[model samples]
Target: MFRSRTKDGQAVTKVTEAEPQQIRDPQAPKGRPTPKRSDALAQRRTLAKPPANRKEAAKRAREARRADMQRQRQALAGGDERYLPARDQGPVRRYARDFVDAKWSVAEFFLPIAVLILILSIVPSPQFKNIAFVMWIGVIATIVIDSFAMSFRLKKGLAERFPDENRRGAVFYAFMRTLQMRRMRLPKPQVARGERP
Candidate 1:
């Protein structure tokens, strides 16, 4: 502010605070559009500053992917449905998993049995190979029968529990779960073997 001397030897001045400018970021939206809950959470959780260059942007992307993978891994081990894949989501899927995990299945042992048979067949003797072949066939038959039986039971249980719910792919989902050893099951078993789901 400046005061100027007038012809009358008096100083007159008008003083007022300067108004601040409302600076808006060109890249920022005027209003945020609605986003999915998960998308919103992810957006809110990102770094405050934007990447300055292509290299930085790529690095950020890699970090985000790694974090996502870590969360998924934790979810699989802890059975957090929020972080689980689409294939394992929903009440019907959860019930199927619980049902399958609550009981033992011959299919779960297929991996170990197959390895044993493979080693047996590696021997030079023809008889050894024949025995291995027979064992393999038996294991295959047992796994198939066990899977079918489990699917039937799962279908019935699903019908009773989730009659009007989407049960599509549930039997297959349960069947895949049955193939994994109880110790290795993704979304680690919520129910212990022989424990009623």
Candidate 2:
């Protein structure tokens, strides 16, 4: 069904119905209304206020920087001179030297020595007291001797290979290489646990 309309001798049929007007309730709650300008102004005022205590923030930042610098200095000086002799060798050679010099390889070789030391240190048995002391001395001596020999060997090797290269750069590179462990992270074939093939 449609309503017919006439204008300037032309007739048109309209099928759509007009939407009903919205009815306002006089007794409706005021909470449903849009926010006023005062609310918006208050929000802007809060946002525009300066942050509290700039001095404390600056002091904290300076302290953090100072602590960081101190740590860096300590790390730089702690082992630099001690490791200088082996600073330019290849990764494998350097690691091998380090392992031997530190007498860590001895521990690897003599598992029983470590176990004995552990047992002696922890157990209160009187019979094994002397044995523990002997093992401790032997381990300590081995580590010291190995470290000195390895350092000497490393220095000799570096001198032979890099006769003209700047020793400082070589040393720095070697130290960084060893400390950062860049070589160990390289992708390579590895023996997986329980793998037979």
Candidate 3:
């Protein structure tokens, strides 16, 4: 008792559903049920190993020995040789490490100078004005030197830290560090933790 409209806009009998289409390609493989997880795991395990030769075993042993020696050397070096430290340590130390690893930018180098200039200009004292002028010149000079020095430092740091020279990640890290001024906050440890220490 379904109703439908005809192409000519007159009333017509409604079709309930369309017939399923049959596959015409005889070469096509029939669908099968997916293998169970355990079955798949068993298959993988079966294909996993062929047999380790003496040379392969010796190579693995050598690699293990090299890794052990490297670890021993790192421990003797006071654990500072590693660029990234392990997690689960105190927050303060982690923050310090992260700050040191961070890169800086040109704008970051100028930020202190700009702030110093503003502070000096705002203060109303003749003697202070003379001091401010000299200080401002010093600040400008420092900014210039820091800019060049930071660039080289960042490049070297990235090369040392990453096996691959990931310039893009390094640049991004540097920009974020500059904007955050993580290193500057370190000297005043109290401020770093949002309190006076």
Q: Candidate 2, 46: how far from true, in Å?
A: 34
Query: Which pairs, if any, clash in model 3?
Result: 103-174
Highest lDDT: give the candidate number: 1
How much is the lDDT of residue 105 in candidate 2?
33
Q: Which parts of model 2 have CA positions greater than 4 angstroms off?
A: 1-104, 107-115, 166-197
lDDT of 2 by residue, 1-197 (tens): 36566777666766455754567897888644667899889767755864468986676678768877665554334433223234323444343334333322343334567777888877788668878888788887885675455456656666776566544443333333323222231111122323321
Minimum summed lDDT over a 10-residue window in model 1 is located at 13-22
- Candidates in order, TM-scores: namely 0.72, 0.33, 0.32
Q: What is the full ranking by lDDT, best candidate first?
A: 1, 3, 2
Clashing residue pairs for model 1: none
List the candidate numbers ranked by TM-score, top first. Answer: 1, 2, 3
- Per-residue lDDT over 1-197 for candidate 1, one digit per residue giving the tens place of the 0 to 100 score: 56888999999875547844578898988554669999878777666678889999999999889999998999899888888888888999899999999998998898999899999999999999999999999999988988888888889888998889989999998898888998988989998889877
Better of 1 and 2 by lDDT: 1
Quote the lDDT for 56 in model 3: 71
Question: Deviation in angstroms for 179 in model 1?
Answer: 1.5
Which 10 residues in a row give candidate 3 its minimum summed lDDT?
A: 188-197
The parts of candidate 1 lying over 4 Å away from their true place are 1-47
